[model samples]
Structures are given as C-alpha cells and as structure tokens.
Target: MMKHQIARVLVLVSIAGTCLSTASCQKTDPNRKETIPVCGEVYVDGQPAAMLQIQCHPVEGMDTQQPTITQAVTDQEGKFQLATYEAGDGAPVGEYKLTFVWQNFSAVAASYSGPDKLKKRYADPGKSPFPLRVEKGKQVDLGRIELSTK
Candidate 1:
C-alpha cells in the first residue's frame, strides 16, 4: 500500500516537473479536472524517517517562482502525499526541487551503532538534508536518500 502511493506521486512529479520538453506527459483527457496523489518516502539506514519536513520548490529561473510547497511529513511508514490541483488549475508543469529535513534526538542517534559517527551528529542536531527533483505530471521516484549528520 505504501509503495503504491509513493509510485503515484513520483509519476506526477515526473510529468509536471521535468526540465526537458520531451518530459511532458501526453494528455489523454485534457478537459477533465482530477487530483492525484504524489507520495514521498524518506529512509535512514533502512528505517523510515517519520515527520520530516519536506518541501517542493520550483526550479527557480526555469519555471514560475512558486515558493516551496510543503507536503505532509512522512508517516511512521515514511509515506506522504503531494497534492495535485484540478487539471487546468494545476501547478505550471515544470522543474522542481524536493528537500527533506529532519531532526534526530540523541537517543535515536546512539542507536545506529556503527561507523556512521557523522550521521549521529547531524541526526542529533535534527539536521537531515536530501534533495530530489519533480517532473510535474510524472513519477520521479527518489527512492532512498541518506543524509550525513556530520
């Protein structure tokens, strides 16, 4: 269920945010108004990062200067939904940047138990960073992004 949702969101991002003109997705029904879910998942050392702050921003000069639009934080299972407006009123299909930031408490940092000392530091400071791109109406699966606390 979780993977399915993520796939859907990734698809939309690909369709709407791709930079290449060829990245555009063909409209089978151009006169319809529909909203689709573009989901995201964040993981750290094979574990889901819950409640991380994630935002979607346009690619600056490449498209409309729409500020970063944040999506709901990943749930316990690292699942989140990216909103898509009605067909014609949707985001101006173009490039986008996805950022994820999260805080990791000392208790959690001490649990990684490995050669990831830097990861401990950043996670302890509640500073996690990872960037992904969106392609408007296509799924651009970001897969897993690992951050270094150091």
Candidate 2:
C-alpha cells in the first residue's frame, strides 16, 4: 500500500510538471489582435533606401483614439515587414496613411537621429502620398515604393 501511494504521488507530480511546461511553451499573447503579414520594399532616387523608417497611421473608419501604429525599418536591401504588436507579426486590417522617414544613424549617439534624409517630405501622415488598405486574412505586399529626396 505504501509503494502504491508513492507511485501515485510521483505520477501526479509528473503530470503537473507536464502541464506547467506545456502552458509555458505557448507563445500567443492573450491581448494580441489577429494580424496578416505586410511587407514592402522602398527605393529613394532609384536606389535601395536602407534604414528607412515606415509608419502606418490609422485612417478614418478605424480606431484612432487608442491607435496602434504599425511600423518597420528597412533592411540593407530596402525590405521591410510591418509589425503592430510584435516583430514581423504584421498589422490589423484597416486603411492607413503611410509615412516615411530616413535618418542617418549616429554610432556616437547610439541612435538614428539628426536631419531627415528625405527632408521630412514623407514624414507627415496628413501630407503622405501613400495610402494603403490592409485586408483581413490576406497578406499585403506594397511592391517597391518609389520616393524622392528632392
């Protein structure tokens, strides 16, 4: 009877350990909203614009009061993946006005600051020329965006 009880306790502890491990393995955030992949490439003056910052501002018909702006930074090849809640997780479905800002990275300041390389031409959402619509359940690929510094 003592051996049986010990075995039962061990089994229970093993089951509890398994349950805890499984719960901890889950990566989903309870508050995360569903998202679809959004990617694009950017070019400035016909050349790949690396380290450019892209922002997606919610437009009319979407929640702007507590808005979540989707954003991404261009890779060396000018490629970017928009993320609203997590890296590369994409954005929620909505109409958005796209803004761009290219800044020079200062290693001395450990930041990407200084003057806007694009001269703030595409920095304001109110004055942005790029308007996009992210659809539900469908990946958005805003093919090569062309911008000008002049």
TM-scores, all models, native as reference? 0.43, 0.86
Candidate 1 matches the true fold with a TM-score of 0.43
lDDT per residue (tens digit) for residues 61-88 in model 1: 4323323233445678776665544311
Q: What digit string (tens of lDDT, one per residue) describes model 2 on residues 32-139? A: 667889999999999999989999988874464545768999999999999998899898888889999999976688789889989999999999999988888899
Among these predicted structures, which one has the highest lDDT? 2
Worst 10 residues of 2 by lDDT: 60-69
lDDT of 1: 0.50
Where does model 1 exceed 4 Å of error? 1-36, 61-68, 84-92, 104-133
Q: Rate the local accuracy (lDDT) of all candidates.
A: 0.50, 0.90
